[model samples]
Target: MSGERRESGDVRGILHPGEQARHRRLTRLTVGPALSAFADRYWVVRWDLRGRPAYRAEVLSFPCVNVTFERSDLRTGGFVNGVCTTKYVRELSGEGETFGIRFTPGGFGAFTGMDVGVLRDDSAPLAEVLPAAAGLAERVLAEPSDERRCGLIEEFFAGRGRAGDPHFALVSRIVTAMAEDPDLTRVDQVTARFGVPVRTLQRLFRRYVGAGPKWVLCRFRLQDAADRLARGDRVDLAELATDLGYFDQAHFTREFTAEIGMAPSEYARAASPGQSVAR
Candidate 1:
């Protein structure tokens, strides 16, 4: 996904410009798998987005699908469904768009009663499961009620008998902590907080989240920082590193590049509009 652009009013939308003035606008209707009492799952509500002239997106994962309701000889309509982890990018064209939904890592498990790792393979097409999923999305979007939305999610899990997954509980606690303090958190910190050993924590992460604890913490922390910078915040990289529990700027830079594919200064330059070069 490219940089996100916010929409006005109660709606959320993002626009990604292509090679020309042509752009794609994704207007979200009711996107949210609002945090719930449920264990490890998180539902990203549905959205109704309209593409402008044309654009493309790299399919990073298959947890999300594009449901096309209309199409012409020049265009097409139907939903792209599946759970995927492999990166697949695609160029998109045409106008008039609609809504889509995403099930977070464990969220898919809650909805499908399958192991979260099942989605790690990008080959699976979730198309077989769309009828039920789309029906649920439409109902929730029409009513815009959290209670009903969560009820549907819970019901899905109940059917799968997945409410008692060990991995779900572990990931839930870890995700919650990351959300609370992305900067001041680490695997050690999480283990201490949860009263578990480092080895145990890593096991849980691998079993459920499909990544290591360190990777998860690092990803979310960097993403949090990117979000702040994207929204026009002035950030001091060195201070940011220290505040986020890194030993120094050098360590922070190394990890940032490893995960984001760019050094801190380079990332800041590309992400920030007028930020000065790092000294």
Candidate 2:
């Protein structure tokens, strides 16, 4: 499956895990991070299969909300469709079967006046949220008009206000920095930069992000490396290991495989042009 583009109405799609031939589609007005053009006019759909040893035979249905943090679970079943203002990072297993449809970043701004975040780790009840989102997905898949779609999203967030308690502004700053540049900074460095104690910083991360500073940083760094590989950037895996704060090439590969469920070379091949893998 090399370089074959599929056309489905106004959506153009691509599949990921080229070798396995899994069925996941990404439909968006544009491909990259720039979302200025579609501000107040679009939304995104994502079906993440981040964790699952093999393809599972369950279909997930859930309500849509905005997600701002990275999720690192080996998920198998679920479908996500909604508008979000934050970045998403996930690790997939079980053949990497998932689909996504993204609206322009600015497209949903008018609708979701407030930002939303959803986390469904082992602690949360996936069954409840998945069903709610599934109902919304049925409406979205019906091919509603742009204005109607935006209105539905707006109502969804309006009903669900902020999902959790608000942390201090300092915590927000730290999380944003980790999301933006995971490798350039460290937990000790964050404390030093903000003049806070390490324990205090760790507490902030745990309370707000559900993970410690080091775990968040490593996840983002792996995402950065994955993005580079997806876009066909060639770098010495060994050098990338050192630059991204890994112990060595072997260490990097091990971490990458554990998180991404595939070796770097395998991912690269799957993402190559004409391959079925999603970018």
Candidate 3:
């Protein structure tokens, strides 16, 4: 988002399609090839609305982790965010900026000593993880430009002598499969396909991903629903529900409304050209 290498599907799984327009500009910079093994991208978000209303953005987060620095407070240092199982909601006000490192799925296991499960849906101050990191936020935010900000984070992770989980590659493969395959709507499907026992799959996800297999499957499927809705594609509630492996249309509607904070029809209307939806 900072550099010139923007791709077509940079954040397809995180932000709902067509939803980025509601906020101030959010951009991502590709990591130097050195950190590509673990980090997916470096994201920068800036908003300057001192005289205007606040903005809010919502999404069902992917099962990934991030190390984030917010300029609003320097004493808090920075935070290492773990995978979130629930929907994500952020309300922004005033003028501020943040730099974030979104780790590839299961890629953060090593950095946090695989305390992944404890960090589920939570954040730990970077100072708590490594005392030497106490000044990281202040140092990074002091940079004059996004490019230099990302460079600071990149250099930190690139030089850190940490070891990743042995299952990182395996988990990455499985997660990639879940994101790519539409028929993968059940944990059982993953187990049967991968020849991994249900218990093993559960442990891998809990320890490395900070979420269970079922949650990942459901979240990714819901992402598909959001993608279709945001794109203005004609969607039949019943058929779409079945396509997502829901038991029935009513079941889909209830869960979708609960997780997305709106009915599917309302989400469609909000995602239409020039319309904005925030939760």
Candidate 4:
């Protein structure tokens, strides 16, 4: 599975064309057994760039947390990454490998034993979050084979007891609906259709998903816009803005630039086939 496509099937909103090949080498697999109840998939990324200069891999993050084993120049180890509500960028140098368990929206609530919202835009050492499993990172990363690492993570989560909650399913439904429906770009659309009151929606998202429903809706909208532009579709800013529920083109450009790190027109040009981000 290409890293450019999230396990949720959303195309990554930010892609550095120079790094597309390496990203495609990523391995992603769905979880089996009860762990599947909590996670979307397990992913492994290994790259060996002995003579090549370092590259920065960027992706507009999805609204889910990850339990990961990674040895990097910066991280040097593993971490429990909370849901990131902004663009996520990782600079890559030398050779490194990472294995991650990508959770469904709100799926992390069970393992945390607390409101998942607190973890939004943050990451903690596994030891800190799950003291009993402080050593799991080293143990997992010790294995060179990604297949073994997958088993290790699966076994670890399987024994973690049943951390199931109805809220997990509820959150999944809410996020899935937003991702699937382009027309569902507004909070009121979700409120009126899903029957979740604004206050309740805000509280649940902050607790389970770590972002407000409005943020999640906008996130998906941006994802859609990015995917379309990446396909080389010539888009009109005003029309796109209206479709995305922005009041006007200026508002749309501001929000898209803030979230995606480039104006839509610029991103579209940079992502064209056979093009790469300028060095």
C-alpha RMSD values across all candidates? 7.3, 10.2, 3.6, 4.0
Name the better of 3 and 4 by TM-score: 3
Cα deviation of 186, candidate 2, in Å = 2.5
Best by TM-score: 3
Write model 4 residue lDDT over 1-279, tens digit each, in one string: 212333343346556433455543466776766577778778766777768888777777778888888887778667878777888877777788778888888877755666777677888887887787778899898887666666777777676745657766687888999988877878998889878889998988988788999888888888777776676656677887887778888888899899888987888777775323221
> Could you tell me the lDDT of residue 250 within candidate 2?
88
Single out the weakest 10-residue window by summed lDDT for candidate 1. 12-21
C-alpha positional error of residue 9 in candidate 1 after TM-score superposition, expressed in Å: 11
Model 2 off-target regions past 4 Å? 1-22, 28-43, 46-120, 123-143, 159-168, 182-185, 273-279
Worst 10 residues of 2 by lDDT: 60-69
Off by over 4 Å in 3: 1-20, 73-76, 161-164, 273-279
By lDDT: ranked, best first: 3, 4, 1, 2
As a TM-score, model 2 comes out at 0.53
TM-scores for every predicted model = 0.60, 0.53, 0.88, 0.87
Higher-ranked by lDDT: 3 or 4 = 3
Model 4 weakest lDDT span, ten residues long: 1-10
lDDT of 3 by residue, 1-279 (tens): 245443345454544545554456677788775567887888776767688787676767778888888874223358888887777877667777777888888878855456588889899988787677878888987888778777776676666646655677788889999988888888888999998999999999888889998888888888888776676556677888887888887888888888888897787787755444331
Tens digit of per-residue lDDT, candidate 1, span 84-193: 33333444554333334444445545444544443343323233444454454445445454445445544643444345666676667676677567454677778778
| Candidate lDDT values, in order | 0.47, 0.44, 0.76, 0.75
Q: Order the candidates by TM-score, highest first.
A: 3, 4, 1, 2
**Model 3 TM-score on a 0 to 1 scale:** 0.88
Compute the lDDT of residue 88 as modeled in candidate 1.
38
